[model samples]
Target: MKDMSENERVARAMMATGRYFTATELREQLGLTVEKAAATLGAIRRCKRYITQVIGSPRHYKVKVLKVLPSPTWHCGEVAPPELTDRQRQQIHYLSSVVFKPSRGIA
Candidate 1:
């Protein structure tokens, strides 16, 4: 795997296309320990031009910057849910956390 510096990783992560990313997923992709990944994300949020949206009351592990505009919703296909049941939302949220992550961080 190609090694990356913290700054480079943070830059790439900031530019990544996604809704959000968990520190664990970032750690895995960037080859960094969890602690280091978390620290890098934190630093980026603190020092860079980024915006965050809370999926819940302050969703963790996300520092959203440059709003990634979502595709326009169309009635041309099946809709998943208008209002997800609690259990379904939980499942969706969990899977989402895993699928989205940073491209760089440490080690």
Candidate 2:
């Protein structure tokens, strides 16, 4: 399953600095809209992964992986790219609110 929103990706990146995140910290470093920060958190909040399942309310929603799942890494020199699950991308697209409309012109 995929992690949270892109802002969560940013949050993980910022966390590497070893500084606790404040709202302003997220705002400044990630340059994300405040809504995005909250939405990313919401996505994290909804995550059912064992890594994210148990945290206090207002859970830091830290993008930390607790129990790493093992997968076959040596695929005969194949480097598989990670991908967002279809459901996850659907949720991300829903958050982005990007509309898809048919072209408006005579056929």
Candidate with best lDDT: 1
TM, every model: 0.42, 0.36
lDDT by residue for model 1 (45-103), tens: 55533444424234474655454233233455444548779999888888778666544
lDDT score, candidate 2, position 59: 42
lDDT of 2 at 53: 33
Candidate 1 residue runs with Cα over 4 Å from true position: 1-5, 49-59, 67-107
lDDT by residue (32-68, candidate 2, tens digit) is 7777765655554455422333333464433333332
Distance (Å) between predicted and true CA of 65, model 1?
3.5
| Poorest stretch of ten by lDDT in candidate 1 | 65-74
Q: What is the lDDT of every predicted structure here?
A: 0.59, 0.52
Question: How high is the lDDT of residue 48 in model 1?
Answer: 35
- What TM-score does prediction 2 earn? 0.36
